[model samples]
Target: MNTKLLFSIAMILSISIITLMCFLSPAHAKSSTSPNIVLIISDDAGYADFGFQGSKIIETPNIDAIAKSGVTFTRGYVSAPVCAPSRAGLLTGRYQQRFSFERNLTTKEDLNRGIAQSEKTMGDHFKALGYRTAAIGKWHLGNKDVYHPNNRGFDHFYGLLDGSRDYFKQVIKKPADKYKVLQRNGELLTETTGYVTDLLTNETIDFIERNKTQPFFAYVSYTAVHTPMHAQAHRLTAVPESVVDPKRRKLIAMTASLDDNIGRIIAKLDQLGLSENTLVVFLNDNGGALTNASINAPLRGYKGSTFEGAIRVPMVVKWPGHIKENSHYDQTVISLDLLPTLLAAANAKPIENTPTIDGKNLLPYLSGANASSPHESIFFKYHSGRAHIKGDWKWMTTKLKQADGSKKLFKFLFNLKNDPAEQNNLLNSHPEKVTELRLEWQDWFFDMPGIWTQL
Candidate 1:
């Protein structure tokens, strides 16, 4: 080879290195080198809907595999009972109540479903850390372009901007035009005939293939099992019509599709040689609804209620090398923990001048060095009434849904550990505990934003 030719090759390589550094270096993106993070969120999945959580009705073998391969939190929790607010809390790592967020993401009816720009999100932090981020599937956090996923640190955004859309419709972005789907940051391609769940999985797999060479963050938010009752026919073959009740058959179909999609993603992770290196966190946005016939067994109340059914959710984290396999942690963990945990795993430092975070890094707690509860007391304020859970005692107002579609708040207390089903109300027996929790809730809500939205 001639010296001139060698020099030319070196020049080209140096330029390429500079360009790559501009995109991946911490000075440019504020991130540390770590494993890829894939967050798989299910919409409206019931506590007992999956097999791992003691459900016999629906068979979710692949999701169960994550439990066998990683850590499963028995007392995992979501911040809210609804999709929009729950996501807001999860992404922001703060209480949605702290910002007076009470409505769905659909702003067409004067309801804004997204979070305010003032509050920082996990995506924002990750993006700063030089990670290429993509958000696939349901983005009910916001419908407007300014509030879209791309605008909030995600470099790529696919799926519907609205909470729900027609599944079979070939065109989601431009249903009338045929195959032109909404494309934000050149990531999402409009589907023409595939089921929504399958389509989401396809996009995710495409992302993995495209960005496998570098660190990437994929947020696959499955819009499964939420209202519209539409799912692909292929994934719903084994259901017995008798067992699959008429009112919930559509939901069952959606659930099956979601499971298959998860299977595909998990399979792809292994195929792409990223399974052991990727940190996968699976969770539901909120509690199940009786309206959809999702039974939240072994727990009282439903979605939008201040019961274990509403807040407690299935949280599984799988990272073969980092987390212990087949381990179950009984300590209560919150959705807010995701932010610090992910950053900690990535070796990314927190911002110096940020507000106080209500979440704690679960690594130490899960490892058993930390003995205290994540929070000594947790405050719950749905409406005018307030409740607090401290140690084993819980005090709250029972807002019974009346026949006329109104709520009747009844104040009471219960020892959750003693009576997990909340069958026994110890308000009379434990007056002191109730008083203590009440004082705590009041003080917590005092500095909160101007309260409204309560019915």
Candidate 2:
């Protein structure tokens, strides 16, 4: 063959090899070195309410798509069973109880109550590493200025500082309703209109677009399907006829809206060409609430209780190049692990001179580098109730009021692997297991500060 012809053939072969390598390489190989983190949290959502969690009545296609593309933790749990405390644990990557944030603040008067100022939130950690951070939606951590999102390290904040709020502007009759009124970086926006869910989604998309060039940690917390049974009239009409209860129908509509907004966020990521390097996490702040007709079927107890239904929430994590598609982690994992996971993804470490975090980095476990569970034992304590989970066994105690107006402490045990519903108690049958769990709980409780605020 001629020398020119041989040179052309060799060049073609080289080009073909390069193209094949690019196609087969992991997702991260084609993306930026540092990953952008988007943590999307839904409030008071049920475990069985979304398409990903096997819901037939409430549709969540967008959220389900995330599950299909990432890893789903079937036994995932939050550090606490309620809103404020659970969020404290989630953002700080520590058990809230350690900072004396055990109970939910009932009234707006408890301004002093919030996540301890000493704890470093997810935003704080990410910001220190040069990532732009934003917190949107519910900011239940604290209403106090000291505990505000801006003070906690977020560059931008848009949401309510209180726990619950009316979904529509018309419903918010009082202009000075601190809990219901929307705020942007401490500025109260009394004239804000439209569905809060959609508004929060807009803020998230804007943050992503503005910071597309750099790494960002966007905490998109949505307060949907929570309380007041407020659903848009049009959305309510979309609910299936099979849902008989008016409240449940409203809940369905609200959930559907939430799912739609999640889809919008995901679409925004794709549109910006940031999906490959963005880590999207979806989970409820806690479990389904007792009101609002939210159902936590197959799991015993509701929000505010030390039961699987209240603590075990639906959690999904998606990182295109990192986590395998349609993966499921059945072992016990808690929301507290999110911070450490994000840090590990950013190739960053926890800030020095800070207290040890309770959460473990889940990347190794999720990637098959580590076979053992991320947590050996997860503990819970709230008010008069307490619970502990080690391996498959869960030991719990509940305070029951008697007819005579006295209170009695009741203890129960169950092997979640067999009875996730907690219908069958093995407390009497397995005294040794109960004793072991009790001792462990005691040690954990001993280290925790007492409840800092009155409920």
The model with the greatest TM-score is 2
**What local lDDT does model 2 show for residue 296?**
89
lDDT of 1 by residue, 1-455 (tens): 99999999999999999989786676444323488899999988788888889987677888899888889988788877778778877887787777666546443443343566666777787778777789888777765456778888788887776666667764434432321244446444553466677878998999998988778889888877777677556545666557757646666667777887899999998998888789999999878877677767798778777788877888999877778899998777788888888888887866554456677788777667787777677666555445677777778885787999998878778888887678898888878887888888888877877533421
Error of 2 at 430 (Å): 0.8
Cα error of candidate 1 at position 453, Å: 12
lDDT of 2 by residue, 1-455 (tens): 99999999999999999988875543323235679999999999887899888888888999999999999999899988899899989999999888888878775456678888778888888887778899999888877788889999899999998777888873455533675578889898988899989999999999899988877889999989789778899988888888899988989999989999999999999998889989999999878987978888889888988889899999999999799999999989999899989989987799875679999999999999999998889999888889999999999998766999998998999999999999999998999999999999999889677777322
Residue clash pairs of candidate 2: none
For each of the candidates, the C-alpha root-mean-square deviation to the true structure, in angstroms, is 5.1, 7.4
Per-model CA lDDT versus the true structure: 0.76, 0.88
